[model samples]
Target: MTHIDDEPGTVSEPPRGGRGRRTALIAVAVVVVAAVAVVGALGLGGGGDEGPGAPPRAGSLVPVTRATLTERTEVDGQLGYGAEIPLPVKATGTVTWLPEAGTRAKRGDTLLRVDDRPVVLLYGSLPMYRDLGLTARAPGGAGDAPSGGGTGTGDGGTAAGGGTGAGAAGAAEGAAAPGARTADGGTGKAAAANPSASPAPTGAGTTAATALKGMDVLQFETNLAALGYTGFTVDEEFTARTADAVKRWQKSLGVPETGTVGIGDVIYSAGKVRIGRPGVRLGQAVGENALTYTGTARKVVVNASAAGASWAVRGTAVRVRLPDGTSVKGEVASVGRQATAPEGGSGEDGAGEGAATLPVTVTIRDQKSVGRLESGPVTVEYVGREVKDVLTVPVAALVALAEGGHGLETADGGFVAVKTGLFADGRVEVSGSAVRAGLKVRIPE
Candidate 1:
């Protein structure tokens, strides 16, 4: 056996056992060195070559695009019907009326029958009486006689009793007597005693004495006449004639010709109607002085105020972000004419008072788009000016520093300050000597 020493200067061989132990120790040292190298690489990998400190890596990015921008204003309002009318009970009778509620009536169609007996007596008596009295006082009591009765005078020139002195006296007495017999053997006593005896006059037809008036009524009447029911004549004043007209108008308009206009009844020109404020029901009592209808044009209006108002204007296009994450394009229809006081107070949070604003009407440029939007809280975005074909970067790519500026991280772990322009759609336009398209940037992972 040859004896070997492990020392370098000695050409000696070690025992097999020692050789195996040395091999095992070498393997352990190699593993320890590799682990140390890996830990060092992880800690120092983010250091940029440009400077001792740099922005962290960015995790995401977005692209820039060129598009047309439209300015817009935003407002809130409700959907409403164009027209409405209220029908009231004009005659004061139980609703046993004609032209059932909600039924269509035509011109001259019967609407409702009131206990017109009262009104007839109230209006008809005097005229009938006057005419009857005139007939009773006529000469020879001829008018007083029934229409078919013959005259009392004979063909002889001398009156049957006029030649006798007693006859003349008797005739004079007869005419003056409060109660006396007539030549026809019929009693003229009643007519002679009461010269003014006559039956009271009465009204005819199923019309109301009181009807609605004002522009609303006229508009309704005009519309009714146009519908081919011409029985009604428009007289600005609400009268029996007007009531009759309304009934006719209602029938033509496809509503119950109840002689009374009620809320929700379509009156006036077609498509130019109104919605009642309080609403109208069948059999509901209405009167000339009552508020029976509202025009379609009347509606609640809303406007923006504070910074929002200043940022928006009429005719400017805006996007309304609904709760569902969908968006609708709308134009600023108007600004308030007057600034209202803040809802609570003038504190920092208080809405300021009397902020004058102007009203703007936003015509629905696209009805389909507007239909998706509901009347409620929504986010509005007004498009500003646009920049085209410029160098840009994702907003996330830029790191905000303690200093007043921002810096971008380079692929090799270097940082550079960048000049930024308009920011939009998650990207910002940037200008810098070292910045270029397609350059890799580091952001926080």
Candidate 2:
């Protein structure tokens, strides 16, 4: 101590063994303190303020609900009757004897009268000759000819010269001279004897003397019934009784009482009669009027544009939305057998004033309801397949997570990843570990 030099702010090193022991003791004390602190926190039940095993704070959330879903398709259409017909002029002539615009006719009753022109004789002599010549040239033509007769026999017995005799001789001569007559007055007597023979009728009973009877009259009566008239019977023959009934109906309706219902009358009664050209006028030739009358319009038909027709189907349920927003339900009754574009216009082009559309018929199942809005515009809808019992969540409850995904706050103040499913009526279905039945969730404010 007497020889030690005093150095400023300097100290000498201690013994190595003693220094190591002191450091170890300090490390042990620090470890024991940390363990005690951990044990205290766990025993405190993981309370807030850095307690061990405590869950993180989370936003509010909602649990997903399960529901059934149905897929639907929408369309547009109109309400109409199941049957319709277009009355056309039965025979071409000047219009005559039109009772009224909306007259009703019984079956077999005269609907309209055409100017009774003499029966038109369509001379087929040249055509017959040509046909005969062609047949003669055919390989089997000669074989078909009767024996003991030449080409004249097959020429309807019209030959230049031939004998006139009874039985076989007359037959042979007739076969030879189809154009030529035989002597002995046999052909003349035959013609005189057959004076009662007449030409067969043609062209759908549209003749001057064509009286209505049988099926034609039945159709007429059927059409009348469809128009809501029920007084007369369809006997397929026009009778005074039918005409009387028609006249009575016409009078009741305050129309002309001519006792005859024309095509115009039928169409008008059915509610689809147009009033332009070919209308019934006074002094028009009865049965000779050029006015074309279609059949009675029993069913209402609306034509759809090509694009609309493409999506339509037979018997597809349709809803008619009215201009006033009221709606009625029905089904597609029929589609046109053929497609017609607007005359002189392309399909892609907009329809012009004169453009025609493909016809479609929508049948009303509930006539009483449809009758309330007849001839009105409408919109239609169709329903498709259904989906059942799927997990769904409210569209508003999802939160964006940090990993570019969605998450839901768990009841235990934790976060969970969920998978989503079908979306309908503003709700989305979801699935995930965090998603469970009756699980309370925290949603972000």
Candidate 3:
């Protein structure tokens, strides 16, 4: 259960979370085991359905008072690379050369060289599937990149890069775009062996190949545009410009300048990734598990309970407390709706049992906060909303009336109808004409 701290008004009382509060009357302290069924009732005020002031119950009397209320929840989280992602193999070919483990590549650099072709990296969330490039006979005047955005085609020369294109959040906009370099720093783009000549992929296909649909095609266009290839609009379908772009890309890459893209020609990823150990040695058959890469920057993930998920909302402000007692600022990057096992396999509610939680990803805005810390356990504190200077009474003081309303027992034993409001520190906000400072009300223990 999460604990709430109180801030009293005028009346002196120890704040539940430290920073006590003051109230005009007796320091009001209330603790309710059950959550208030209606929170909006606190905002509502009008004539009560019940008749004049009356005290019907012969119970203990508690005075109405004012105070500030806040709720705080603390949860455990781990600090480290946001998440580990596996770079899947998109092209079918023997691994010619793989970057040594720990070798980090920039966003647009080559992470893998398959059959001497470059598999470039970009920063984006969408995954590449189909082969990307232009067709020999495109519908629109023999040229253009995808419609969304892309670098247009160049004259069968060098595949240009750094072209401007619309960017998607979380998507890798690699600096090189596509077909810029191979593992050996060679352009797989062999300058058209003969000026006005086309190059080839030793034993593979070229841009003259047909383009496949899906996110894969779209990303390729985005990659090409980012690489400075413009002239065609970035879109999903292959166009003459895309083919021209492909030929130029191939030409610049030192490969056969075919105006088509093949599956084995290029690979797309989110961004340049530090190479992990190769799954297969050079010249080995490619497998499903290609390689894994982690985010260059560090981040933290919190497995929060469903009830506590509101604090972990996307973009919510967060304060991370590191093991060294240092504090850092961050924001919720993403929240997972899927439920997974809690810390203890059960939950924070009790002994390890049937407990599940929501996975929340938090990104550290300031890299300096992490300093030299690599990874470790950390604490996260969420500061929820605060209700201030409101008429408050002990939760026990509220009684559900039979006439479709809630009320408080007056000093004369008559019931004064009232509405409930923000609940905090076992105290609740109550509003009604019958409510006032020092007005005593009956409460059941």
Candidate 4:
């Protein structure tokens, strides 16, 4: 029986400088040996009870099967609370208390205490940059009133106070400063023109005041209402009713009922947070970088190659291999828009040196599925490509045809030309009129 170990093809060597006659003889001998080897490999030179189209006697046969093919890429990742974000304390005070690292804090919870006063955490996108309070309103329209009123409804459906639209009233009041009432009940046209800056003095001899307003006001109001402070409609305007609720909330916190929210009184985050270490020590002056924080949920961060980040699209389903040899379902939460090279021009083992990488964040489907792992190295598998219910055969079963492309040898010694598709594992996707599941194919040993 003849076995085909090497491929059945001609082997050529580069020309050598020597005697012309000897070189020619050696070349002829090499060609003869190559031809004999090809004949044996093709099962034509062996004496066997096989037909001309039969594969070598020692070749193995495998049946073609249908299966789902997926191309996956695994990359090293870190399991932790995503990324640490710096939380700078904008308020001027000495740090009286700080939460221990890895402690979780949620909305309406005191993250830390400054000067014995608690700095609460709220949910919002905008940061608290100014004080929020209800500005004094003029009794009636006198002179050119700012034309703004509190549209916020009190315990009843009635408007909170001054007759003005909800959106416009809060904005106008926010533009003016506390105590400085405008002729038009705190809604100054000048304030509306520039809400960020304090309202300018008008010819009516009224001093313009600055009160906190805008979406930030609305965000705080939303949080306040969520915390069970009722009797005030949640709106952008901080009306008298809103101030009353604020006082109640302050009383609950054991703080003075100032009826106003001062800057640094509350910090805004998206949702729940896991507290990091405090930059300042106890009784130390709180600088801008007083503390750090991160999302409470567990996540895996992967620094994927920028060139191969196409599979890191947000919402893409993935699998995370844990250190315990277990895997959990996950999905891509975010992909960095910019690619950055590793610092010092060299990357870690996962990322090659000098390669630009895009940060990819993956969130586990079930928070409790991760067990007790807080932070460690992990492996994330991303599916790069997928093909379902396709006929496939061992890659070794493919035979290179002299013309071009590939063919498969059937059990009956018939050759079926096939078109190759996705290659995964040790199998190659095959399609042809004659290729079907359960069809046996020959693979040379």
Q: How high is each candidate's TM-score?
A: 0.39, 0.38, 0.50, 0.64
Better-scoring candidate (lDDT), 3 or 4 = 4
lDDT of 2: 0.44
Candidate 2, 291-398: lDDT as tens digits: 333323223356666554654678776666556775567676677877676656764544554344677776666556654554555655444434578765544444
**Candidate 1 lDDT over residue span 56-165, tens digit each:** 33344333323322223334543332234553323343232233223333323343333321111011111111100001122223112232121122221111233222
Which sequence of candidate numbers ranks them by lDDT, best first?
4, 3, 2, 1
Give per-residue CA lDDT, model 4, range 389-419, as digits (tens). Answer: 9998755576655445567665544456788
| Each model's lDDT | 0.40, 0.44, 0.60, 0.71
Error of 4 at 161 (Å): 25
How far residue 76's Cα lies from its native spot in candidate 4, in Å, is 1.3
RMSD each, Å: 22.3, 21.7, 20.1, 15.1
State the lDDT at 258 in candidate 4.
90
lDDT (C-alpha) at residue 304 in model 1: 48
Once superposed on the true structure, which residue ranges of model 4 sit more than 4 Å away at CA? Answer: 1-63, 137-213, 342-354, 394-420, 438-445
Total backbone collisions, model 3: 77
Residues 161-241 of candidate 3: C-alpha lDDT, one tens digit per residue: 322222211012222334455454533233323336543322111123344456666777787888877677687777777
Cα lDDT for residue 352, candidate 1: 48
- Candidate 4 — which pairs collide? 145-184, 146-187, 149-169, 176-209, 176-210, 177-209, 177-210
The list of candidate 1 runs beyond 4 A from truth reads 1-274, 279-302, 306-308, 346-375, 384-390, 400-404, 410-414, 434-444
Which candidate's TM-score is highest? 4
The residue ranges of model 3 lying beyond 4 angstroms of the native Cα positions read 1-71, 100-107, 123-127, 132-219, 231-241, 270-278, 306-310, 342-355, 389-445
Worst 10 residues of 3 by lDDT: 163-172
